[model samples]
Target: MIMAYLEAKGAKNVRIVPLDADNEKLVKGDFPSLGKTVEVAIAAHGSSTGFKSLMNGKADIWASSRSVKEKEVLAAKGFSDLEDPESEHVLGIDGLAIVVNPRNNVTQLSKEQLGLIYSGQVSNWSELGGPDMTISLFARDENSGTWDSFKNMVLGKQFQLSGSAQRFESSENLVRNVLQNEGGIGFIGMAFVGKSKLLAISDGPAQAFKPSQLTVATEDYALSRRLFFYTHGQPSNEYVTEFMRFAQGINGQSIVRNEGFISQNVESMDASLADDMPADYVEMVKGAKRLSVNFRFQEGSAQLDNKALKDIQRLAFYMREQMPNSKLLLIGFGDKRKNEHRSKLLSKLRAMAVKRELSRLGIYPQKTTGYGDFNPVASFEGASKIKNRRVEVWLR
Candidate 1:
């Protein structure tokens, strides 16, 4: 969608050539801009295929719905660490929404329950407090990044998808299948939910949250994930570099929001203290409104990840233009720790890290606080623990 928008408005005398009649696989276009004609080709395959193409010198960028895997990084011969911030670019945010037929009474589920359903353990809707109908599973193909993310985030290593589950290459088709089947369940990108009913998902002890623009943007939703576009290190191609710059700018973010994904643009909304929240933490944010962006760090470190670094710049821009005089509060949370004091201190340090970054941009926050091991967004069992370590911004 971003590419199509750019081709229409940012370029002149555009020419499009489809490799196939459907134009679903390969496309080449000549976009005239800035006194030059830049030729660009896009191959719309599965995410794994994109990485394979990049490794084989067939593509300059790898568009993916999930993060690069360790094995893929090791396989790229000449590419710098694909996990590096320079190589990994977060395009936008998406939530993997569990959808079912609109007539289904089941409206919410725990992560564990979802795992069971997909693994074929809970094969009947009655098993989940729903109608007495046999459940049918629908899933993305093996090569799709959507499948990869769902496998890692929901299924995990303990369970594999049921052999009888139907696989789809298209999100729309999967949603359609679920819509037609009364007992069918499928996971899809939030944007593709269509007429299917969405289920609120809870992880660990956190409250259930449905995939929404705000929840996905804040990454509070259980299945929220980042969409990415990876380049070989810093992108040697001039056109690729220029396109990336445009995609990360304000106009590009607008296109992202318009296309039903959550853009990185900073926004604020009034929030009330929840009853389940800790009293002290609730008091801190009593009358404050929360921002759409959260500053999260790398695993086991205070260093901001690639997306958070970009968010700092976006937050700065937003503050200068919209809330120059607003008082900012930073609240940090951490995963469970054996030493309570150490956990609290570490959480505070994470907030301080964000403060320091914002300070460099001449945006000083008024207060920073830490709430260690309180209101975890995900379980502390595995890789999901990283989601618990984050700093949230609020306006007084």
Candidate 2:
């Protein structure tokens, strides 16, 4: 659809070509009405290649499934500051969805369970409440962005996948493999979920959340990530800038949704909670001042991600300098999953995790408590459950 729109807007002789070394598959389309053709190179060599390709002048635009890293930006400094605001564009958002055979009765999984499964810590389906059978694991090859996201978001930064895991270069192939194996589980972009049943994921013990427009757009889904486009510096070419503008514009975002990825235009935050929410839960925010930092756990793990770790450092500094005498209250919230008692306990743990981290930095909260599944700042079902799975430090 983007290609069709571009062709309609007069981009001629547009051909997507791949380097001979690229092993990923290719997807191509043609718009005869506007005399344009767009070929998509699908080699799963990871997003790092996109930045390298852009810097070398081999590609006009790098369609990346992940954000640009600091090192990649440094590598591209010779030609253009690809990291510059004018050069970077967010095309869409996607959630790395966990998929299982439709016949599998398991409806949800904790991120820890997934990490264990992929890392071969738990090998049998019965371990996760399924029938007695070996759990077949399928995954994208290391070259793919999906693999990168899954490794970092689901598996911890240092954890390596099990040697026995099957690796596929194409998401379509990976999904097909999963379809044929009832005991198989794999991760893929929401775009490729198709007939495969998507497992609702939980960060801790909270209710499982599925990948949906609401979740992915708002980054409530644990594996939700941004999709990007990188150009050499500010895209000096007229056509390049126009195409980017269109990609970020309404029509492009519509196409993004149509392609099964979440649109960037979706609201980032939710302002209201469910009507049936407890009055006290809703009132918790009435008087206490909210913190600028929102501390959430890494998907399924107690450890914080790099970003959250940095945020924690900054927050500790803020508390020491800005509110030295003010009593800090840490409120933890959880997604609606399991029973209220369990959810509340999970929420409390999340808050405690934040408090513990702050304590190491010499900042301690006056009190910390968890509110089970109440007062969501984002959708609780399929989107941004992370918004609820958070610890908010308030000034009391």
> For each candidate, what is the lDDT?
0.87, 0.73
lDDT of 2 by residue, 284-381 (tens): 64566655345666666766644466557656766676667877778888788868999999889988888898899998788888887775544464
The digit string of per-residue lDDT tens for model 1 on 1-396 reads 434645745655555656663324333344443555555677766799899888888988899999999899888646678988889999899999999999999989999999999999999999889999999999999988899999999999888899989999889999999999999999999889899999999998888899988789989889999999998898888767877877777878878888889898889987555578877777778788899998998876789999999999999999999999898999999998999988889989999999999999999999998989887888888788899999989998
Error of 1 at 384 (Å): 0.7
Candidate 2 clash figure, as a count: 7
TM-score of structure candidate 1 = 0.95
In terms of lDDT, the poorest run of 10 residues in model 2 is 264-273
lDDT of 2: 0.73
* Residue ranges of candidate 2 with Cα displaced over 4 Å: 10-45, 80-82, 267-396
Quality of model 1 by C-alpha lDDT = 0.87
Worst 10 residues of 1 by lDDT: 21-30
